[model samples]
Target: MTNAVTFKILEDIARDLSSDEITFPTFLDITFQVRSALKDPNLSVEQLAKLVGAEPLMSAKIIRMSNSVALNPSGREIADVKSAIVRVGMEAVRTVSFAVAMEQLLKSKQMQPFENLSQRLWEHTSHVAALCRVLARKLAKINGDEAMFSGLVHDLGVFYLMSRAANFPELVNDKAELHALLVGWHDNIGHALLSALGSPESVLEAVRDHETDREISTVSNLSDVLYVANKIANRSSCWRDPELDGAVDTSVLDTLFDAETLAEIIDESEEEVQSLKAALGG
Candidate 1:
């Protein structure tokens, strides 16, 4: 499938999914699945414990991961499922599990066209997540772990597109270059899909309004985080958009960390990506 057709199918899927009045049961199912596979973004660590503990499998995984040598910085043993979730935090738990758990759900024949696409998407999202953290701490002088998580999942719309390709072969066959073809368009699509899936308003808004002009309506801070995080994606390759270079809507851009700080963060993120590439023998 070419890139053009993929986006076309995505548009159709978006329209069809949007037009269908999702029933309460369906809504609840989506909510349950998203929640079950991951923790609530708004829930506190203690709250995450109770929520995750409700599901035995997730709790076990959480506990095992907390006891994993890599995540447990201090190497303290977790006593319970809740404690494990609290120690790791909801997004971290969600990040670890969602990618692992959703695999079977997203499997299909058309997924072949996207062979390695999903893997690259994960790598890109993870890098963007890391960049978001770097930007938040070094540039904005703020904690952006949450921002990093948001960045990590922002391009999930593309994943949904791949999943739907089984149903829409034209979309599966889209042939254009990926970045040039669908950049501005996918935000609304992502927003609607995740909203239909019962994500929080902040996440939806970040997806839907991330690219919307402020004159149309001011974007939320979370959207700002996504916008800049995406803008700096692929180690500043996306930032060369002449269309957006001098454009207004300084709301997020102004609040973005200073240019010098951003430069440092970008350099560091490049190093991180390179290190990851080297680790993978790239």
Candidate 2:
């Protein structure tokens, strides 16, 4: 927890980043397969369904997401993976794959030591993702699914760092010290990790700049939507501990939307957000 230890941890991460040797959990195997499958333009719905069905948990989450209010506004429901895939689309299925992977990673024995932090991080991730979807659709006029995916993975670096921190018992037990290290390194680490994962350029850009403050009169791009969404979500972040962390400043939102409009958006999206969060296993 001392400065020397923090420097050493940062150095270790930097070495991994430079060498492109960042490690991912075993649970991400399914997620990688799903993403790889989705990249094939010739992949049929049935084929994707078959692939998804191979992983029972991912398949179940896909079906649940397809039935969520965010994706399925109608009351009608479908009971099969194929139907679910058709309803949610390929991108959404990819998002669900990540949702399932992260959920599993948190439950994995390796991450058990940081269960509390993992849960908090997941909750914050869900909130930001839901907000991104809503904000993208209602304000940015961008693809809601893409925005949601960006939000979900924006803090991916933090998760990876926590996983790595499992090797450092002292760091694991010191919440304040752990939080400081994560804040200092997550953004750059996330960008590198996403790049290594072959994430879309737009998504990589959003992740890289989500924490960077900038003046914007409106939400016009994915980065803008993510920035606004991240700020808003941080108002009640999982990383927040009054005794360990300081209050998050969201005043930049005032430059984008008036108080009434922002409140209205939050109010209207509350139900959908919660629904999507639950669908994502929040």
Task: Give the winner by lDDT.
Answer: 2
Find the candidate with the highest TM-score and give its number. 2
- Stretches of candidate 1 off by over 4 Å are 1-12, 19-31, 34-82, 95-97, 101-109, 137-145, 177-184, 211-220, 236-260, 266-282
Clashing pairs in 2: none
- Residues 138-179, candidate 2: write the lDDT tens digits: 999999999999999999888878877878788887778888
TM-scores, one per candidate: 0.61, 0.93
Pairs in clash, predicted candidate 1? 1-172, 1-173, 1-174, 2-173, 2-174, 2-175, 3-174, 3-175, 5-171, 6-171
Residue 193 shift from truth in candidate 1, angstroms: 1.8
lDDT (Cα atoms) of all candidates against the true structure: 0.54, 0.85
Q: Model 1 — which ten-residue stretch has the worst lDDT?
A: 273-282
